[model samples]
Target: MTYRIEVDQEICVSSGRCVAEYPERFRFDDEEVAEGVPGAPPLPDDATLRLARACPSGALLVFDAQSGDEIDIFGT
Candidate 1:
């Protein structure tokens, strides 16, 4: 199943890691906070999880597209 990705701007530290790694999926807003690109193709589940986990500030959020449920990236 495809996953939807989002950025929690309040939690973002402006690290730019997401933007640098996935330019097509993420970009910096006027406030310099990271945000997901609209209309961008979603990444595979594994890759999406990896991207969220890679965020230094844990600002990247992942959701199950079909269910609209948020994934617990840090949960075991």
Candidate 2:
């Protein structure tokens, strides 16, 4: 299933971790916040989940597109 990957712009620190780890899936937007590339093919959930977990600022958010359920990588 496809996933809706995002970064909370307010919380983002432009760490580049997500972009560094998944350049094909994430990038620095015009505002420098990490943003998922629109229209990119779905990446494996595990891969995207790992990027979300690696976001030091906890700004990355991943949700199941079909289910609209947030995948809490932080386990909080």
| lDDT of each candidate versus the true structure | 0.88, 0.81
Candidate 1 lDDT over 15-60, as tens digits, reads 9998999899899999999988989998878888898999999899
RMSD of each: 1.2, 2.1
Clashes of each: 0, 0
- Listed in order, each prediction's TM-score against the native is 0.91, 0.80
Model 1: lowest-lDDT 10 consecutive positions: 67-76
lDDT of 2 by residue, 1-76 (tens): 6667787888999999888877877789898888877877767877777777888898988888999998777663
lDDT of 1: 0.88
Candidate 2 has which clashing residue pairs, if any?
Answer: none
Clashes of 1: 0
